[model samples]
Target: MTSPHRPASHGIPRPRVWAPLHYPGFATLFIGYSVSSLGNGMSAVAVAWLAIELAHGHGAGLLIGEAVAAYTLPGVLVALGASRVLKCLDPRLIILVDAIFRAVSLALIAGLALTDTLSPILYVSLLGCSSLFGLLGIAGDLAATTELLPSELHVAANSLNSVTSFSASIGGPAVAGVLIAALGPGLVFAIDAATYVLLAGAVLASRRYQPPTPIVKSSSAGIRDGLRALWRFPALGAITLLCVIFYGLYGPVEVAVPLYVSSVLHASASVLGGYWTVFALGATLDALGATSIQRFGLWRMTIAAVAAWGVCLIPLGFTTSAVIGFIAMSVGGLVYGPFIPLKKTIIQRSAPGELLTQVAAASGVFTVSASPVGAALGGPLVAALGARATLAFSGLATVTTALVAVAVLLAYRRRTRKLSGDR
Candidate 1:
């Protein structure tokens, strides 16, 4: 097998944005993942709208919160188990299994909705079931990217993945609004389910072009090994903690934004979809442009992005105009676009190759849980403070978190410099 890190000498100069697609294996996976991401993006809108329809009476906010949380929280447990049960499996197999299981679970939900037998309990339960492998799938995809490209291209590969999802966001919600209006959210979900099947096929096809290395069996230390790796790399631990805080703060927006559009703006689903579509449009544009600014350093880029995102979101809290909300979301998306790729790049560079999957999974356990936990809290916050106030509060708190991170990062740099002088 050729060295995964060996750069291909294809004398042809490709645009930086399209560089990653030059590799066959990564290209194949990227194409499949991009198609599936459109479905996921549609489901993002459909799932919340469906929950709102099912929720009734005073407890609606809490129920909506539970329904949204259900989609991702279950993955926390599955991710924990991955360290033990999934460590020996090939990354491509992990991706395939997740795609298959999610497809089936979502198909069941769609079927129940179409049959008029979908209760809130069943809907939430099935949503939870659909995401059981969510974290593992993410870890697998990252691991597979590492195997498919050299280290130098990993950042670009990660950016491409983010760009694909954001691009789907641009089209998916707009299309979903039309679909939901015409055929209802159930059909939209069915479409998403079909996309997963395509993703499974993509993973299978990639194996034919470039087979992944077999994972050697290791001592069954489980999540402990992953935790040890995090401990050994303080930077990873710090980055993971920042992600947990940042995502947790952002979670309330998931609950608040929908309510704000529905109740505050008194807008239809299309308007709500419009907000997301605009946000995604900005994100996609910024992500494509990110390669140009990477020389600034990932840590600096990440901090600045978070601070700017919080600032952008503050405008939404004060404005009731859908136009204003759209503007805020669009700016927010630009600031938020670089975050995932930058975070993933840091993890990829920081982690040991042997423990990449475990470290990703372990870090994922916290980062993944953060948003859901915040969403669960969002219900009560929205109920008590109103959606507008909740949006403002989340923004303020996120800004504070960024400031704390900045201070911590500066102090750490100073300490490191002092230690080097002593040495």
Candidate 2:
């Protein structure tokens, strides 16, 4: 058994399902990411709980919404501008710095809560400040994955990364609930902070396989270059546009899910909870053993996954029975799990190594930016269409978009092959 630390052959042999774990650096990176995911799980519960605690009687809902917005919106803002700064530094440094800022800021929030001096202004500011580091992720973590792992193992590596977050999604909230019950929500923040500290340590200890390939360009030029590369590559452009459509259309479903369960299905809140749990469970199970899908080819698998995801939602819209709906949602979750890792693997494999980080950043901004637009549209759509109609539209739109992208991708491949033959 060869150590994952040593470089290995780039053979596309039968998918050694556990091949990625052999790479010590990837293994270390995996652990750090998994821990961070757990912390994120805790943070989600803590932030919402704390917001409720700090809210007076009036405008409590508004305050909670604002705090959540503060945590998320800043990353979009930072991602827009940080590409140039990220191009100038090692991505690992950016990740480490982000982790450190989050740790320190979370600790401060805990301290303030303990002292009975926490205010909405201070709370929002700390969370916003802490979130700014996440914008660096466009260039850091996924880019680091490309740098550390061989091309053959990219899918497996991303699968592991995706699963870590899913695992955390399940465990983080449970533990956070226990701590909040025993101690308080503030303690959850402190625990989350400690997880970041551990993540930073793991990142600090791991090695980079490639040197930082710094791009020498003005800020405007760097940003332009990143944009131009995406536009220049038809496949990349199509995939990104597909991402925008799929993500935007899917956003409405988030709003529709709870509404459908409560109003349409006439189920308890726990049933809605079961809906998500089963979905996550399906995703986790699929990710753990998805290496076989690689045999079908990355592009085909990606297209199929997106279409399958949309297809899964159709059953949800048509079904009235909670059991049947749960089955549909679970299938969606199973198919949805592989889509992201496959997408990331495709991007990293196809992108130029030098511009990989910047390209990823730009794509990240585009895709993430679409979700809010989708969410904003979601409320109105649900009002107009109703939950079942909205869910059906969201699913159908996703499928239509995937089919269109597949057609475009196929045409592009034919042209490229023809041009190569002509040359």
Best candidate, lDDT-wise? 1
What TM-score fits each model?
0.86, 0.92
lDDT of 1 by residue, 152-263 (tens): 6777888899999988877887789899899888898899999999999999899888888767778766566777777888667888999999999988998999999999
Model 2: lDDT equals 0.77
- How many clashes in each structure? 0, 1
Report the lDDT tens digits of candidate 2 across residue range 1-423. 111232222344545757887877767767887888899988877888888888866677777877777777687678677755666766677778888988999999998987878998899899998888675654588888877777777778878888888877778887988998888888888888888898888777775533444544444544456677678755556567778888898889888999999999999988997888888888877875556676666667778888998998987778799988988988888998887777776677656677676777777778876877797799999999899999988899889878987887678768877987999
Against the true structure, candidate 2 reaches a TM-score of: 0.92
Question: Which numbered prediction scores highest in TM-score against the true structure?
Answer: 2
- Candidate 1: regions farther than 4 A off: 1-15, 48-66, 115-122, 258-272, 317-324, 382-389
lDDT of each: 0.82, 0.77
